[model samples]
Target chain A: MRGAVMYAPGDVRVEEREDARLVEPTDAVLRLSAACVCGSDLWPYRGIEPVGGATPMGHEYVGVVEQVGGAVKGISPGQFVVGSFFASDNTCEICRSGYQPSCPYSVIMGSIGTQAELVRVPHADGTLVPTPAMPPADMIPGLLAASDVLGTGWFGAVAAEVGPGKAVAVVGDGAVGLLAVLAAKQLGAERIIAMSRHEPRQRLAREFGASDIVTERGNEGVTRVHELTGGFGAHSVVEAVGTQESMMQAIRSARPGGHVGYVGVAHDVSLPGVELFFSHVHLHGGPAPVRRFLPELIDRIWKREIDPGKVFDLELPLDQAAEAYRAMDERRAIKALLTP
Target chain B: MRGAVMYAPGDVRVEEREDARLVEPTDAVLRLSAACVCGSDLWPYRGIEPVGGATPMGHEYVGVVEQVGGAVKGISPGQFVVGSFFASDNTCEICRSGYQPSCPYSVIMGSIGTQAELVRVPHADGTLVPTPAMPPADMIPGLLAASDVLGTGWFGAVAAEVGPGKAVAVVGDGAVGLLAVLAAKQLGAERIIAMSRHEPRQRLAREFGASDIVTERGNEGVTRVHELTGGFGAHSVVEAVGTQESMMQAIRSARPGGHVGYVGVAHDVSLPGVELFFSHVHLHGGPAPVRRFLPELIDRIWKREIDPGKVFDLELPLDQAAEAYRAMDERRAIKALLTP
Candidate 1:
């Protein structure tokens, strides 16, 4: 099987790997149909995050179940499925309460990576949401979107309580933040503000439902949000950039009693206490419990109710995985979809 | 009129002052029946919080409405009233959204000093909760409790979602924490754990409804809470102290998806981003919008359903305001009430 691996920072390659097989009672072997580069992957690629030797790369994918362990229930081989970056036993107390990311017996599938010909997923019964059936080729990107980005963006919107008559702000211009703008609009937010300095990203943000755009950074960005919100700030703020500046910007852009849903994969981030105390904004966000929204997202995608797949402006053959990483690393592509 | 003033740290004195009069259309002059010392007062008294010379003190009070401004409606002269430390119009969007403390037109009564014999209350129509006639002399303490501590404790319980079948943990041993114990019990919490090291406070906590007491601090305290909750921590945690240790304890003591309602006036508080992000607890707190709880609290106090005023362990004549401050500052009293 061919899989993408990062030997070190800025070093991505497509190479032959051993076949994947179910290793646990709740495991399932998947034949990857589609996989994509994620914003978080840029961390190590840009030397911002430590990368060990030859680590499996990618965590977002839609695939067909090739094999299932005996203990797996509610899923079987030949089924098309979308799974979150983390495999979770949905029956755990935490998972039952709708926080699957923190599931008691969860495993990070991102480490093993989904950018491959075949991948093994644990907790199959809880993590995989089967599509109604195999869909047309164009639906693949949207279905893959459901595996991570779309669900994550939706979680950010819900976490921020973005809905009817509410004002929402998106703090990142990446694919996830652009999708968050779509999500806030779908959730009925009256005003959706996107913070982006790039013309291409800003154009996509507007297409996705952003009513306003603030190209300013830091304090100036916050000031723009306040000015747009009658000096009270937005009713909800979505944080998709995992940086100290983005976090503060998200918090500062919300009104008192408003909610901040931050889905960014925090890296070397430290929030000062006094600032948050006075901000008086409700803080709730972490690695999103993406599995919690996979089922609904898959349904919406299959029905063509949302076109989140538009985020993937670059596509590559599975064998050209290195180019996919390079394109995303250099910001030439918002997201790069790989066909296996 | 006479009022309590702080010339410097540990220098509270009783001094003659000009009588309070209605200064705005919505203001009302109140003849204070009672005022009390607060834990927050000690911040400036002990110089933990800087203060200028002869600053007026006291924000908690139960009093008689001696005069009403032209715009004041519903509330009449001679009505028994209870109000929070911060006066809010309670009609603005922020107030209507239940964030009265941050109301656009909020006025801090602490600035004017309710410790005076006569006090002017702005936004009187919306700030004062009129009691039924004269509350019995014995009920004065309970009514006084509703002025700030009790209302704040109730807000904390509500913020933490302390209700039937839930486990609650309190992170302070002050009057507000003890009252939170009572509020949790009233709200139907099945288990109330009070974190206290002081013998007297522990006894009072138990009396107020704490089913367990953890004398531990920080990680140890969280471990004790986990041990009590079958290793999952409490469903709700009330933070009555605003220090980093207390905040972290409250956050750590709650299970994922649990809520922390913090009512303590934040002082030198700072939160680490990663810790808060991973804790996954729902965080909400600030100077509690005590006005939000006053109506129901007044009813409960009037009916003698709960005697929250028991938190006040000492009483003194208004002229001895200095001694009352000393008792609380020296830790000889949990709270002290001053009568005019």
Candidate 2:
């Protein structure tokens, strides 16, 4: 089997590796059909974070079950499935409450790494959401998107309570932020404000149902949102960049008693308690519990109701894993899908 | 008219001042029936906040309208009313969206000082909620409570989403915290845990429907809450204190995907962005839009269903305003009520 591994910053290589096998009774072997590079992957690729010995890469994937352990009841071989970044028992109290990311028995599938020809999925029965049948080739990208970005964006919109009659502002123009515009529209938000300086990303935002666009950055962008909202700011703001500037912009763009749903992987950002206290904005975010939305997202993709895959501006063969990482890290591609 | 004025830290004087008169078309002059010292008043009294000359003291009040401006249609002379610390127009978009504390034409009623025989309330139509044909003599305490602490506590409960089947943890044991226990009960929370060390406050919490009490402070209190909830934090946490420890404890006491509603007047508290980002807890707080809850609260009090005023442990004549402030500041009383 071949997998994506990083030896150091800005260094990605596809190397032959031992094939994954069922080491636990609840684990199942999966042959990945599709995988992708994530925005968070750039943190280490750009040398912003520490990278030591060879580290397995990628956490998002959709695949076909090849072999299953006896304990896996509902999921079986030949089934098409989508799984989240973290594997959970789903029977735990936290999973029952729909917080699979913090599941007590959770395991980071990233350690096993999805960007490979074969991988072991732990707690298969609970971690994987099986599609009704084999999806068409055209549905691959959209389903793969649901494995992480789309589902995370949906959670961000839901956390911010974006729904009918809401004026929603998004602070990021990445794959997740673009998908969030689609989710907010699906949830019935009347006004969608997308903040993006990139022409291509802004065009996609418009296609995804953004009612307005603001190219200004930081506090100026917040002021523009207030101007559009009659000086009261939007009802909900989504923070997707995870930087201090982006978070503050999202917070400031919301009206008093509004909600700020931040889905960005917080890196070096810090928030002053006094500012948050006086902002009067509800703050909710973290590593999104994408498993919670996997079922519904797969249904939507299978029906061709939404084309979240449009976020993948570039695609590559699994062997070209290094090029895919470069394209995303250099901002040449919004997202890159790899066919394994 | 005589009012309490703070010349500096630890310097409070009862001095004669000019009587308040109608300043705006929506203004109403009220002969105060009662006023009391509040926890927030200590901000400037203790010199944590700067004070210039003799600053007006007190904001919580229930009073009889002595005069009304021509445009004040909803309230008239001789009407007894209960209003919050801020006077809001209630017609602005923010107010319409239920954040009346940030109303476009809002004014801080505290600046005029309620600890006087007569005070002017602006935006009378939107600011004052007239009592049902004048509350009974004994109900004065209850109505005064509704003016600030009771209404704020209710907002905290609502923000925390306290309801049946949920475990609620309260982070403060002051008048507002005690009242939050009452609000949680009214909202049907199944279990109420009050964090307090004071014997009298703990007793008051029990009387206010606290099903359990934790005497520990900070992290220990959070641990106790987790122990009470089977090692998972409470579903809802109400933060009634504005210190960093209390804020962090409230956030830590809630389960992943839980809600924390904070209402303490923040002085210098700050939250680490990374910690909050990973907590996966929903945070909402600020100066509560108390006007939004005034009608329902007044109705409940008028019907003799809730006696929130039990929090007032000290009663003093209006002339002894200094004593009222001393009782609350010295922690000798949970809250104080003054009669003119």
Which is the leading candidate under lDDT? 2
Query: Which segments of model 2 are wrong by more than 4 Å?
Result: none
> How accurate locally is residue A180 in candidate 2, as Cα lDDT from 0 to 100?
94
Q: Model 2: clashing residue pairs?
A: A273-B270, A273-B271
Chain A alone, TM-score per model: 0.98, 0.99
Alpha carbon lDDT of each predicted model: 0.90, 0.90
Task: Return the TM-score for candidate 2, rounded to 2 decimals.
Answer: 0.98
- Model 2 lDDT on a 0 to 1 scale: 0.90
Candidate 1 at A228: error in angstroms?
Answer: 2.1
lDDT for each residue of candidate 1 in A129-198, tens digit (9 for 90 to 100):
9999987889999889888888889989998989999999999999889999989988899999999998
Cand. 1 Cα-lDDT: 0.90
Task: Write down the worst ten-residue block by lDDT for model 1 chain A.
Answer: A271-280
Tens-place lDDT digits, model 2, residues B229-340: 9898999999998988899999999999899999998767877777888788999988888899999999999998999989989998878877777777889999888786
| lDDT per residue as tens, model 1, B1-340 | 9999999999999999888998998999999888999999999998889998789899999899999999998789989999998899999888898888888899998999988899999999889999978888888988999989999899899989899999999999999999999999999999999999999999999998999999999999999999999788899999998888898899999988789998887777767767777677888777778898898888887788899989989999989999999999888999999998
Real contacts recovered, all predictions: 0.57, 0.74
Docking quality of model 1: it rates as medium
- Candidate of highest TM-score: 2
